[model samples]
Target: MPTGVAIRDVREQLFDAAERVLLRDGRNALTSRAVTTEAGCAKGVLHRHFADFDAFLTDFVLDRIGRIDARTGALRGSAGTGTVADNLTAALTALFESAAVAIVGLITARDELRARLRRDLPAGVPVLTEAAELVAAYLVEERDLGRITADADVDTLAAMLIGTAHLLFADRFGTPPEAEGVRRIVTTVLVGVGPRP
Candidate 1:
């Protein structure tokens, strides 16, 4: 005797509750019982919508990434013309800022979930190497437009930026000062290649 309206309402409530649990308690606290209690639904409600916890976690990560991407896209038109170093630093900083919560979610995901993420990452997921290549292309474009110094090696500088961001945000080394880290990245990359004084 499950009404369609009731089922849909329950599903939405459960999902919203699950999101709160994730934000508040991290991955370790994500359980069907927790979600059910938060949603004020029977525990079986979660299983009805999601095959398992892993599937729920996967969907959560993908949804967060989509939200972050949308926020980053909002900054596109207003990105001012600047030296390659300046533009790249602004872009990276904005991306990180917009993505902080999602980044925290990724950081706190459980080992099993992390392993699943590694195995199930979408083909289009931007890894460091691919990101560096894309950045290198952008640098080449910037150089041709005379926004970057003539001596800059676009590939190397892009690789350095990618590597630095990965270290700051990915691996465990304690969080770096956001502004200072961005400045250091720009300075290190632009030191030899920037316009001569």
Candidate 2:
């Protein structure tokens, strides 16, 4: 029925609007009424899709992580195809860019959501660890292929890149890191660990 279609459309709109509210205002503003208002729907619409606020919040957090994972997968396909530093910078930047604000908001509210995220969601740690490990493997491969300096400590350098990304995320939300700011950090890490050419 046309009414059914309209209701489905409105539900989709509400879900998206909730994400925007979470991103902009953090967890404090993610009430059911707020989401419905943002979606221009009545309060009851939220319960039609989601059972409760906690369920909605749980799904929202997982959805955000899934989005970032998909973005990383896309970036990986194009990685190592360009100049090493350029590709590495692009890959790493893609990992952190849009998710920075959301991540910062989540981290700042970790005390409230940490236990729930831990219990309900698979921690993103494995994916993050895998990413860093792949970076190390790539460095070792490049060195073996004579594309990079032989002396670089691949794992250490990979860890440094990952650690620096965390710092950059913090800086981005707290102080609004500039283009030059990110470039400086990336270039510094690459210069120390990347190929001489």
RMSD versus native structure for model 1: 5.1
For residue 133, what is the lDDT in candidate 1?
59
Candidate 2 lDDT, 70-155, residue by residue in tens: 66554445444665556556656776675545654554565545566667544544235545765677667666766567898878
RMSD for each of the candidates:
5.1, 4.2
lDDT values, one for every candidate: 0.61, 0.64
The runs of at least 3 residues in candidate 2 whose Cα sits more than 4 Å from the true structure, single-residue gaps closed, are 1-5, 9-12, 107-112, 119-159, 171-175
Span of ten consecutive residues with least summed lDDT in model 2 = 121-130
TM-score of each: 0.60, 0.69
Candidate 1: residue 141 Cα off by (Å): 3.7
Stretches of candidate 1 above 4 Å error?
1-23, 34-43, 74-80, 98-137, 149-156, 166-180, 195-197
Decoy 1 TM-score against native: 0.60
lDDT of 1 by residue, 1-197 (tens): 24343655765576678767765676568787888888777777677778887676666555555555554443333233555556676656655554444445553456655666666564323333345555677777766666567777888887788667655664333454476678777778777665454
